[model samples]
Target: MRGFDTILVVDWSAAEGVRRAERDSIWIGAVRDGMAEKPRPMPTRREAETWLADRIGSEIAAGRRVMAAFDFPFGYPAGFAEAVTGASDPLRLWDWLAERIEDDARGRNNRFEVAADLNRLFPGTGPFWGKPHRDRFPDIPYHGRSRDGHGMAEKRACEVASGASSSVWQLFFNPTVGSQALMGLPMLSRLRRIEGLAVWPFEPVDDAPAVLAEIWPGLIEQAVRGREGIRDMQQVARLAWAFSRLSTAELTDMMDVDAPEEGWILGAGHGPRLTELAMTAPDPMADPPPAARAPLEPPPLSNDCFALPPGVHWTPVDEALDLLRARLSPVAGRETVPAVGADGRILAADAVARRANPPGANSAVDGYGFAHEATGAGPQHLPLIAGRAAAGAPLAGAVPRGQAVRILTGALIPEGVDTVVLEEDTRTDGTAIAFNGPVKRGANTRRAGEDVDAGAVLLPAGHALRPADLALLAATGVAEVEVFRRLRVGVLSTGDELGAPGVDPDPAVTYDANRPMLLALAARWGHEPVDLGHCADDRDALRAVLDGAGTDVIVTSGGASAGDEDHVSALLGETGSLAAWRIALKPGRPLALGIWKGRPVFGVPGNPVAAFTCALIFARPALSLLAGGGWRAPLAMTVPAGFAKRKKAGRREFLRARLRDGRAEVFASEGSGRISGLAWAEGFVELPDGPAEIAPGDPVRFLPYAGFGL
Candidate 1:
């Protein structure tokens, strides 16, 4: 009463008394003015029936709408059983039971007398009631029973009808008791009649507070409050709580209830509890979060920032690729030129044919050729007229009828001649020619422009020259082509301890590995690599080398760090400007970016391993940008761990590893300075910065050499 506006507690055993109690509860709780007073409960089934009849009669007399909840099962049980058994008529089974009860109670004086009397009045027909017990009811044969019964059967009819009509009544069973009862016998049979009601097998109840807390706090609270004013309120409250708890998704699923929408408000209060319920409700229609967003910043240019010691750079590999794509996008233009044999390069513009292939009609092979009339229909020997028609020669004269003329391969076919007899198929007889076989019309003739027309387009713009393209262009008389300018990249190694290969080694110095590596790398990308030689640990010397490099990009190694002998950073600071330094990464953290003499300069760390890793990670993207090409790193794969280690988060780390037993195993010495570790490594394992340590059995992402721009 304190919580709900109206509450109805159904009690079918004492229908009249329960109805009165429900009416009183509703009357006491009503606050609205001019509301009709709730009626008292009828004390017995007879009284309840009389009250219903009287209420309906009064409603009809007054012309008013009357609504009420009943305690009968209605047709629900039969409907339920019909659905389960796929039967056409489940009520027949109920009638069969009624008949059996009546036959057993015919003379017996007991409570079953009512049940037995009802059965005889409703003898079942149809497949649902297997041939009614003939011997038991021998006096009343099974053949002539009515579908709805009569006389003594009419009493049984009430009970049979009660089983179905009683369905509407079970709604008030103490939730627990009602649920169990509905799961069994007569009530179950009645439930089967309700259209589209799904019922699952009942499960035993358990007192799980966590589950109760999540599912039914509202019901529990209501039941607790109901105890203050009602008899057996605690029992009802517990039953309500159990029923609410049992209303699980699995049960609702069987009931065909749609899951609640996610993020929807539930209940009337605005607090954490209400929010929790709303959040916990299953959401079959919830939409996924929007796809992860990318930065709106334009792709970084080579001269954007310089990496110095202690500065943070946040560009990811994807961003780097985007920058390269932006810088390397192609410009629109076209040009056309000669392409013959292997000389055809990519066409810069559409080319129109200047002349047709096969300049004039001619013979395709050598033979004594003439019109069919000149050779005649019958086999006859004829004079061989002397007339030459080579590739560039015209026929001397038309042959007379019954006479043949001499012609060579690729010679023009004489006018008025439609065929040529091969020399192998002819013989000389008394200075005359004789054909051994018949010649077809248009034989051995090459027509002008058979392959292409003079005004047609020979090749379109942007077509890469292939061998066949070359031949076609040559045949079409195309002579020149325009193409994109090749990109040039300047390669330089920075460090007093570094020297070029083949140079005498200084015990304290090492040969410059970055130069040769960069050269080969640049060449692979279609750029001309200019070697600027090695720069000593002098700022002026490095600048002088950079000034004269004249390359679109300047890549240097060994002087990016802030060490005492490291001069690349000082050189960049004094000569030009630094863009960014020291990205949030391990191993190859010391990186320098800046512009020198209007050219982009990247100072990679000097350690052999570090330099190579940084080149693959950073320089490759920068180079792609300079060369007018897009960049993309290969994909990473998940592999089993080969060893164990600890790592910190916030910075990305890479370790040299090898595939072993189908798993990626880390090298013994993973230090960046250990070149041998890299040499022995087949790939790299990426480690995210975190407090969690990786164990031997932990799975990790392995980046094979192919994935790292190798």
Candidate 2:
């Protein structure tokens, strides 16, 4: 599909009303054409609205598609939407919340009161729980055990697939998505009126210019962690990059998902596949020399190339990557190119020296050359010889013993001249040169094969060529080298609300951001990046772009999860090729995976932060293998925790953080919508699958940006 041209990832906050906390507030990140934009910190819900409106308006003005993904739940479980709004359309719930949510600029709102009232809609504790322990209400409870008679499922299907995600009924504590949903749904309701904006799985996925979806940052957080800045900022940036690298086909597959009522997190289930591919992939170094390999082999083509594991839920991030490695392989062809043009290319075979470096013995200094003598360490002199030996012009006759000849650097050593003195150490005379030393035999002269022997291994296969490597190739008489062709990784942003950066600004639209950042990232990592541009939400338009892309893979932002029977969803259904890979992680659950026209496509949330994180954690390594660079596993280091934190069990989480005083300090908020936290973070502090209560000075694992090649 044409996919999304821009990605905007948001991390939402619910710190207001009864309590006015201000740690991790609203954060918005934008990625245009594979390039990440500066994250914006929204201090208030009102300011966040204006910021979104203006940015989205600009994107719409420029005719780009935008996918704006919020970290909070886009909708409650199936029955809750209907119960609250008396309508099947969850968007109606947005309207309901908008009418009742009383919010202001100073982080004050009546969310608790509204939630309490909503809880009263049904008999007995109608499911709103996790309120503050000290604050009590007629129906709301501080603990789930205190509630009763709630008919709806406590956790949505997406949450169940996420393994250990908190129930939506839980409004506070333990990384629940409910509190933010209470605070953010109203904003979504207001923004719904923006031109071309459509709620995913609630409207035609491809019919609109802008698509709104839910996102979870945790999926990629585990693979590509950070701790240099606030945890929130880094995840969004990383997530944005991840989505921007997906192919049009991949995006289409993601858009073909079936989550209708309860929303799904973007890029969740796909992490395992990426991890698998990176971990189990055959080493690029194992490839035979280009001359010894068979002809180019094509990748497998099938409707189910991206099939998600059936009946599997709660997959860890590492497991997801492992699956991907099992399913994918190098997709590029081998070709020969001049050694000089091979820089930045992945070698298809080991490189061997054709000839020894320095070819033969030569002079190492510009001075008089003479036979060495076993004399004492004192002044010595030799009579002048016949002619000078300059580089590319060696003296024709051999030098006699006790006689000397002037030799320039790189000049071939004259026969019988075993040593040469430095010009600085010799006294120049008309017929003779003098130096104070007992010159050692064979000194100041290079010997044959001194640097490298003929037919020696110069470089291993799969090694990415660099300038220094070229020097070795040149010295070894290697004029041509075989390398794998660059992988064509493409990106597209969906939604009508996206436009070029300088369009007329509105408070509801966003400018293009994801495409630019992703393309640059691919290029930096030595892959051929293709900009597929923006496509409207219409499935036909997206299909047209997909057919013309001619890329090996495409990444899409937005439209991963569409409304009930959305056009894009139907399109995928008709092809019977779309699958949702649901992973067990916070911030991410079901990721889009699919195939179209033999090209692999993956869809990522338009949220810049989530998209970027997914790209690094999953897409980067996958592309590395596809581009014949082999699988890439990001490096991580053990570090100390600078702050205290309590994390729930059954899921892994990567918190954006910065290293301070040799310890990891996590972001103030866990909201995935907060892109500012990502910007502030340098790496992530990875928490294990089991529950953990970390205190100050405790051990932790930190994944830096450099580790992921960021």
Candidate 3:
């Protein structure tokens, strides 16, 4: 067997509409080696198809062996397919159903109808039934029950063997899994047709880059019961863990199981082995394979490459940003808000100009308005008109011939008058005005629609509104604007060595500084931060809090590094999912990213300085993405290095610094635990990746704390 590189577990769904990482919707869990990568969600089956196609292509191109598992059964009971579709072979049946199933991206699916249609070929009621809420699929009966001498309710061999699993024919009762099967098998059929991918048990697994298989989460779920956190997430994690830890002999034995028509579950009869392996396995990050441990070239941007070997797991900052981009997308909900109250909100749609800036031509200054060519030469005078045009009050009648109107600043220009002469340049009498200075055409005259035109986009979507943007909105005369809702962030602090400040502390415990700092930072960014309190270095307590934290994203400050007291990473790998990112950056080195209860969670180091640095450098941009603005690199400017210092190579460093005498100055201390360094420093002086000698007057990149929304 090829060294398995990637394992993808998809908990398929028959429900309509895009859904969050909750129950009954699509949650795709993937792992490289033993580490769980980010699981992508698909609102509709069509999106899953498109995403899987691209992902499979990318994985194959990267020379990786991939195993993808879907939760639904791949085949029906032995002879029932032949009775209905006249096909004895399951692949033929797959094709027959794939061509007839109707589903769309708009949450419209004919799963019940397809089931009814297939049941029409059978004798009495059905092997599949369950009337939908609307359009009650009337061609066939809408219910199914096992009756004496009935052939339709026959159970598949696998379903009978796995006592906890649901039967394929029970579409309506007892867990209602038939809908997933009816809707899922057709998609798998389409996937099997792709080149370089093989379907398990049916297709012989050779050197194909990816192998598709059927999985029943129950087989392993029973062995790993009584665990906290989300059941579905744990099941997926266990599946990935069990599959990755399988020895070559055990994997071959699983593949060689005998199943004529019905498919065997991937981990059947190996529950004890999988559970033991999951419980007693050594740390996956302890010792990596030679390929993973080998020093390779710097990783390309994530947009250019998606997956890499586990040994060389530490991603460059640029590549990490790219991977974050791949993991996050803008939220989809939009709301109409009053322009007056929309300040500090992100625009969901483009704000267009309702009308032109100036309704008509107006005077630019307080002066006499007259036709430019009416005065032929200098020192010429014209008769003053009786009516005057002032701001907000325009003269109604047209200008008389050989006459000039007294117009004030911002007043509309009189009809047939195209120029304004300043009062300082002309002497005015009671009845006539004298012009002495050189007069030119269109002097000091404002044109209509100069500032803005109707129907033009004044501000595009994804723009964060500022005070100036509100003024622009008011000028555009737009009463209401569409904007994205603010993101809800949950802040958690972990470790038995932490407690609230000002409280009596244990002899060995310190104050909890990271949570308060994170919460304050999130609030400063105009986001809603929910306090998730604190958790000790215990998995059960952490799991309880994680299962109940309902925010859009989670930020934790501790238990991320690979230490014995680091229970967060270990628990995350067991319950939900986790990916350890050994980022090549100073101050913040160990970063953990994963999904818990369907929401994104970020785990930073325990040190206050390191936690603060990681939150600003990584979490802020991720929050921006969740707020629908997408990711933005920290704003950096080149400034002169105020102090000289020698630095090492390999990792990039962000030293606490402030501008002094027009040059950036570094703080004296470089320790990550120094909280005073953050308070005293105004910004950071960023060092490059490689070693270099910095002297006075050398240019260095400066990143202000304000740029990170501090």
Most TM-score-accurate candidate: 3
- Candidate 2: regions farther than 4 A off: 1-293, 301-305, 373-380, 423-430, 433-438, 496-504, 562-576
Candidate 3 TM-score, C-alpha based: 0.56
Task: Write candidate 1's Cα lDDT for 24-43 as tens digits.
Answer: 32111111011212223332
The digit string of per-residue lDDT tens for model 2 on 656-679 reads 888998999989998877878878
Off by over 4 Å in 3: 1-309, 505-507
- C-alpha TM-score for every candidate: 0.39, 0.55, 0.56
Clashes of each: 57, 130, 1
In terms of lDDT, model 3 sits at 0.74
Native-to-model Cα distance after best TM-score fit, residue 90 in candidate 2, in Å: 64
RMSD in Å for model 1 = 31.7
Clashing pairs in 3: 18-43
Mark the 10 consecutive residues where model 3 has the least summed lDDT.
295-304
Give the Cα error of residue 410 in candidate 3, in Å.
Answer: 1.0
Q: Which candidate, 1 or 2, has the higher lDDT?
A: 2
